[model samples]
Target: MKLIVQIPCLNEARDIAGVIQAVPRQIEGVDRVEVLVVDDGSSDGTAAVAAEAGADHVVINKKTLGLARTFQKGIATALSLGADIIVNTDGDGQYAGHSIADLVAPIVRGEADIVVGDRKPGDNTDFSASKRTLQRVGSTVVKTLASIDVPDAVSGFRAYSREAAMRTTVFTRFSYTTETLIAAGNSGMVVASVPVDTNAVTRPSRLFNSVRSFVLRQMVTIVRSYIMYRPLRAFMVLGFGMILIGLFPMVRFVYFYFTDGGAGHVQSLVIGGALLVCGYITCLVALLSDVVATNRRLEEEIITILRRMEHDEAARD
Candidate 1:
């Protein structure tokens, strides 16, 4: 198996080298293991240290494009290099390199298309207490919405097969680790989690409290991204909410309308009209959103299929 390990770095010169150096160079049945570093416009010597630590390849973006895009770029680079399995981990040394084999083994053995590393709270050292609790809660919420069960959704250490890398989208800039897992659940792919030990991350985290406003914003983005795949359901839920809200007014106006005529009738008519309008607007927007969403999904699928075909043709040569 050809495995390409990806490390997305941003101002990690302090610990990137150690992360790379710690990776085990060989795993059972794995003939090749290459390291690919994605530099997100870091001013520090992160790229330099990566090379020194024995990276097989590197891709540097002109500006700090954010973690999600940098991760996507890393996977693209690794795919171009013919990686059968892609493993992504932080450059901050939070995830132990020795745990990589455990992460990728499921994919190599065909037991799963995506292997996620779950940090059991108090069972691992790589996350702060605050991060662990929030991660567990976040995973629960996401699992409920996606109809998929996941143990740890915030873990950044994971492995993906070529099909997943080709099919999934890393669209968000914050809390992308969890968002990608949600995307996998919606993408008709099988996911598996591997338990691994990580020491508490020694660096400062970019994310804060789970109840913070920023966390809500990122979570909303993730939920909206998936709504593209289920516009009718989303609209129906919104419409139902509006209907429930209008019920009180509807009931009162109906009682008054039957007892009296002018003012009560007008009020009842206005309330009903408003509810109907809201329902109509939501239905319209859902329809429009679905059209655009379907187009984007089709384009993504076409490109992925062509890319896979090219890979097969090249292998034959």
Candidate 2:
């Protein structure tokens, strides 16, 4: 099987060469291995450095498109280049390149559609205590939403089979790590995490400048992706909660009215009625949202089929 290791770079000229060179040129059960560098509109000569480092392919974005888009572009390019498997790593070399073999083993053996590299809990000495705590919480939240248990939900080191890669699409611009896992789980792709070693910290993350910002952004991403994938369920829970809350006040109002012959509880009646109306509206919105979510899923399936057919035709050509 042919495997392509893709690195998304943005102003990473200093570390790109080392990341490229560290990629294993040969692995058991893989006939060929190649490197693809995606330059996210880097002004620091990252593309030139990648080429100089002997990257098999380099695709440059005209403007900075963020990590999600850059990763999507890299996947598309890898598919076009006849890559049977795609492995994504960072351009900063934070992940040990030598561990890529372990990452891809499950995919090569048909045991998993996607393999995530687990950096091991408490292993990142560079991360502050607060950062590590946040990481744990974020990973737990992602796992609950995605229905997949992954120790390192934010790890950039991952491997995807061609089928998984073809069926996946990244919608959020903030990060691909979390969204991809949720998408894979929603699309019924088998995901497995294996322990892998990480290289020492190379540079600070470009995704977020501070821990506060990172937490805020990641929380937004998780909420947005959850809504996108499970809108019906989300809306249903919200609607039900609102209804229950409204019912409590309404019940109290009714009890007061019955016991006192409708005396001195006019305000309670008004408040309860208002809440009931709001709850009913929310439930109506949930129904409409469910229909839209179904349509969206159908559209996605059609697009996936068309894309697979196109890829097959291209391969034949």
Candidate of highest TM-score: 2
* Structure candidate 2, residue pairs in collision: none
- Candidate 2 lDDT, tens digit per residue, 52-108? 999999999999999999999999888878889999999998889999999999999
Measured with C-alpha atoms, the lDDT of residue 136 in candidate 1 is: 74
Per-candidate Cα lDDT values, in order, are 0.79, 0.89
Candidate topping lDDT = 2
Evaluate residue 55 in candidate 1 and report its C-alpha lDDT on the 0 to 100 scale.
82
For model 2, the run of ten residues with the poorest summed lDDT: 119-128
Per-residue lDDT of 1-317 in model 1, one digit per residue for the tens? 78999999898888888888888889886888988999998899889888887888877889988888888888877777788899999988888889999999888889899888977864555555765667677778778766667788777899999888877676677656767777778777898988986766675664443447646865776577568667767887787777776676777777887787547366766887699679778878878877887897788889889878876566455
Range of the 10 consecutive residues with the lowest summed lDDT in candidate 1: 206-215
